[model samples]
Target chain A: MTTPLYKKTAREIRDAVRSGAVTATAVTEAHLARIAEVDPKVDAFTQIWTDEALAQAAAVDAKVKQGVDPGPMAGVPVGVKELICTRTGKTTCASKILENFRSPYDATIIKKLDAAGAIFLGKVNMDEFAMGSSTERSTLKTTKNPWNLKCVPGGSSGGSAAAISADECAMAIGSDTGGSIRQPAALCGCVGIKPTYGRVSRYGLVAFASSLDQIGPLTKNVEDAALSLNTLCGRDPLDATSADLPVPDFTKALTGDVKGLRVGLPKEYFTEALNAEMREKVEAAVDVFRRGGAEIVPVSLPHTDYAIATYYIICTAEASANLARFDGVRYGYRHPGAKTVEEMYVLSKSEAFGPEVRRRIMLGTYVLSSGYYDAYYLKAQKVRRLIKKDFDDAFEQCDFVMGPTSPIPSFEFGAKTENPLEMYLADIYTISVNLATLPGISIPCGLTASGLPAGLQMIGRPFGEETLLRAAHCYEQTSGITLGEPPIA
Target chain B: MSKITKQDVEYVAGLAQLRLDDAAKERLVREMGDILAYMDQLNELDTSNVEPMMHAMEMTNVFRQDVVEPSLPREEALMNAPVHDGEYFIVPRILEGDAS
Candidate 1:
């Protein structure tokens, strides 16, 4: 039997749409229909943009009819995490404060993808302000792992990753601040990329941690991620921090060549912290590289153990400052009974933010508070320098640092939520990439004995996404993980 | 590492403008204590001579040309405001006034 149109990769769908094998409308409809069928079981979407997506797809079909080039991401159904600003619908960040807040303008990537002919299937759930390691922190709804409804689809991009895993969308755009993109991608068995820190624009991404936050795509495989990079990369005048480098055709880098490439295995990532099965899966990935004619080098990142602690301090500090914009006077939820300005600010914020959000804010405030700034915040910034230096030193010896994305695969809901610090530990392998401003990709490598997916994370040098994509493409082809459907309906 | 106290949580809450009731404050005191204790690990690293890195990729003073660019219109900008007065965001009385 032929694969469903919804199950086709974005590249295949784009080619078929261009060649007239299928209409963009049909592709969009199939995905929408699939979402209707499976998203309820996965709870992936917070709001499905049925009408807007159809309109976008219809325009793609119209372009094909008129012989107009429909741009690179043609006819792809894309799910956007709710934190990204989209003028068509509310950009809630899965929080009560902005639950109904409509953005006046679309984010830079949103505008770019719309121009590229990708349909916005809808806004999906995420941790409130993209702050948590699990979707449990999302105030909208909990997004579950597609492989097992009982387990969490790792977050704060859980909705984006789960939607792709469940065949609800052709691709998804997610933000990574302390592994929000890669960790979830790892758990859900999707290929998620967090490009070099300033490689993509963050103009309309509601800032979680300004220095750490970056936007990238979560797709079913590496090729589509390459295509997404082709469309999404380059300097954005809207975002000051966005790099001015020339955007390369990332697809060309996926030549599946790994001979003579040096892959660094950071000894710290494979230590006792990693589960035995996860370690075995990652070690198998090392063998895949060895067999592919790539040299496996052992590198030490001595500061690796400090990543989780350092990331939490820096991110929360930034989040505390970034989230200060949600005052009652501006857009978003506001309590009506305040007779004084001070009362309004306090009451509105207290009522709007969730528990995790509140905890982070308080922590952030404490770190930046006058007496403690140098001790907590400044010390973390220095420690962050050490973390980045470790990567720099490692990259000097190898092309990519290879390891497991998360310490383990997806876990049952509420397993780590009780202890915020425990949840933070899940992202240990991914946090340093953000801290160092390097590109990283998490592609499915193997599944656990019980049938959950494990991801092999590859960290590339600064602005070295080309090599990383090539390596990911190469590893994915040879690695024995079979791309199979989840047990869900 | 210092112990995180209820007073500290309350003080930080005031600074962050999040009004926390007693239950919330109690919860934060414990949670923040555990988290802050974990952060003490950073104290182990002797960063005496290290410069603090604020951003991962450093680009300083990115200035755009001084050209006029259209921004979101007042109406569209105010569309999502909870208490907008058409031309402005209406807020609670800033000055201390008589008790209601």
Candidate 2:
């Protein structure tokens, strides 16, 4: 009953590859074969870089043969969410605008992964411009939840999360602006981390909301998340927002000792909005920490009600400004036969962007408009400060805050498509972390009654990922709930 | 709560440089109204004295060495352009009567 090569964590695969138990090419082949077998039903990947992956894996194998250290993540096959730029492949962000677009540069994380000897399996699908809560907003294709093919993989990192759950790759990279990374990972039964805002560089990650977005890893376990975070972190000169701080090896945090750790349970998060079954499971999962000698205290984030409103206003405002760079002038999709420059800009964006993107853009443009700035945009920013202070106040009494990642488990495709606000509410628990600029991790605690996965979210202070990973690892060790295999095979 | 009308959608769409047809415009009007109504709850919180927090990190004046670095070459930069001349990006005429 050993785990399959494709199902093993990145650390396991990397160790096996470096130890000569398996060749890097063999590891890549296992994942490529798994993707070929499972990805058709899941539709997690937008492109599969067979040749490039094979070549990179072969290079790692060569380094190993020469008795040289092939790096920490040698031969680990990884999925890059399409929103993160990869120089060789298309970085479409699952939108028609960048459908044929190839990035001229690699994102800082991509470069770091390559240097660490991880093989790029190709670009995974995402929401169009990473704007929606569900992958249904992707103009490229709808990525299905591997747990239940009919349900939507919670998104805009749906494809990345699905890729890991479907065992198409050892691990994947995803960006969380709000809950894109953690929500999908929670739904797909994997570990997702949204590091403290500046912990990972955002150099070439396509900005959905500049202030909220952070690049993180989706993995089979917390150790692999810690391992991947080790490679992805560290400041980059190219990004001014990147934290100029020392990155300790995150794997060392997995001591599996939660003896004196104080975990906070936000009362607002466990309200009636959370599905009863989900709340029960999350509480049961938190009990694991309590039983493991960690103290659980109920804390209040009074501004919890304002998080969705503040996040929507601020994120959309930032998104509108960031996305304005994609006009017909420089690159990406261009509408042909425009009578004027204005016509070209309008037609190109209107035709290429999906409905969610367009709606956000319009909402953003309105909020930042002349008369509405003080009322909406500025007000949201002020509220954002209050929201951050709520977390600051809570952390004074507790070490890490805990809750269910989403109020509801995975929903049917198109269920929330008609109502964008309903979809936005799905991120109720996770959005506040981004607003507060803190690190958060979602680890699969248990399955819902319907057999779908639900995750327990743990929020940490800024650069407090080490403590979060330590606590999550301690729970993963004690909970005795192995990640369920998707019913695809 | 402010109602997002068809005229408001059209006006905002103009500002965002997006062209929406009648069906899309109507959908946006409803969706935007619903979203705005939800967001209007922010008015309930008293944020009068709070200063705006624009970025998560409190970074100020991150300076770098004033030096030239390798950049995307012109050919690679223009590779994805739909309409590009040999040297410059070609665009439709902007002026009403004059060709530049």
Candidate 3:
């Protein structure tokens, strides 16, 4: 049987649309129909941009008819995470505070995707302010794993990953701070990349933690990720932190051969803490690299143990400072019937923010507040430097680091919600990559005996996405472990 | 490791501009204390010699030519405000009381 149009990769859809073999409207309609069919079960989307998407897809069809280039991502259906600002709809960040808020302008990546001929599939749900490890924290809706309805599609990009896994869209844009992108991608059996800090512009991305947050794509395969990166990456004057470096054609790095490459195996990542089956799957992936003409180098990141602590302190501190702009007087949901502005500020924020967000803000406030600042924030920053140095040393001995993305596969909802620290530990293996400001990708390594997908994470040096992509693409193509469609698809 | 008291949660909530009820304040004291205790593990490392890395990557002040550039117009800037008078944002009350 031929693959359904909804199941085709972004590249196939783009080529077909550009060649007029398929109308962009039909493609959009097919995916929109697919979304209508499945999203009720998955609850992945916060809002579906039906009218706007059809209108945009029609424009792509018109371009094809007029003999104009339909751009690189022609007719590709993309689900944007709610945190990304779009002029067409609300940028909710999965929180009630921004429930009614509409961005006056599109984010840099939004404009880039639109210009590249991609159709918006609307904003998907996320953990409030991208704070939680599961989408259960989302105020908008609960998103379930497409692989198993009971299990959580790992989050703060849960909706993004779930939509891709369930074939609701060709690709979903997600942000990673403490593995929001890579972790969810891993759990959902998709390819998710957290590019090197500043690899992509964060101008229109609502900040979770300014220093650690990054925008990336969650797609079915590495090629799609590389294509998305080609369009997404570039320095923007609007984001001062954007890297002023050339974004090499990432697709070129998909050199099917990983011969002579050095892959680092960190001893700390493989421990009693990691589920045995997950470790075996990761080891098998490493063996693939070894047999495929790549050398495995054992390395140590001693500061790995401190990654979670350091991340929490720094991220919360940054989040508190960044989210300070949401005063009641300005845009977004404000508390009405306030006798005074101070009361309004407090009531507006407290009333709208969910539990996890308030917890983070409280923790952030405590750490950044006067007396405790030097002990917590300063100490965490110093440890963060050590984490970076660990990666620096590891890269000297190897091209990149490889391990299981999450210590365990996707878990059932409410499993870790009771203990916040436990949920934070779900990102143990992926957090250090963010702390070091390196590029990381999570590809479907293999599945467990029960058929849950396990992700193999690859961590590379600063701006080393090309190498990460090459090795990932090599493993993804050569390894026989294909991620056949999730049952929901 | 230090213990987090109810007063600390209350005080921090105030600083964060969040109004928490008594039950939330009680719950947070215990939760935040547990979290802070775990975070105390960072002190085991001797970071005395390490210069704090405020950002993951090297940062520099980015400058553009001092010239006129397009920016958000007034109406668009106030577009999402909860309460607006078209020309200005309307707020409850600022500065105690200025007899209007």
TM-score to native of every candidate shown: 0.98, 0.98, 0.98
- Weakest 10 consecutive residues of candidate 3 chain A by summed lDDT: A328-337
Off by over 4 Å in 2: B96-100
Q: For model 3, what is the error of residue A106's alpha carbon versus the real structure, in angstroms, after optimal superposition?
A: 0.3
Candidate 3 lands at a TM-score of 0.98
Clashing pairs in 3: none
Quality class of the docking in candidate 3, CAPRI style: high
Top lDDT: which candidate number? 3
DockQ of each: 0.85, 0.83, 0.87
What lDDT is reached at residue B80 by model 3? 91
Comparing 2 and 3 on DockQ, the stronger one: 3
What is the C-alpha lDDT profile of model 2 across A1-489, one tens digit per residue?
A: 466788788998888988999998988898999999988899999899999999999899999999989999998899999998888888888888988888888998888999999999998988888887778988888899998999998998999999999989988999999988999999999999999999999999998899999999999999999999999999999889999999999999999889999999989998889999998999899878889999989999999999999999999999999999889787888887676788889889989887788888888998999999999999999999999999999999999999999988899987988778878888899999999999999999888878899899999988999999999999999999876688853
| Count of residue pairs whose backbone atoms collide, per candidate | 0, 0, 0
Each model's lDDT comes to 0.91, 0.90, 0.92
Runs with alpha carbons beyond 4 Å of true place in candidate 1 = B96-100
Cα-lDDT of candidate 3: 0.92
**TM-score of B chain for each model?**
0.86, 0.88, 0.88
When candidate 3 is compared with the true two-chain complex, its DockQ is: 0.87
Q: Order the candidates by DockQ, highest first — what do you get?
A: 3, 1, 2
On the 0 to 100 scale, the lDDT of residue A18 in model 2 is: 88
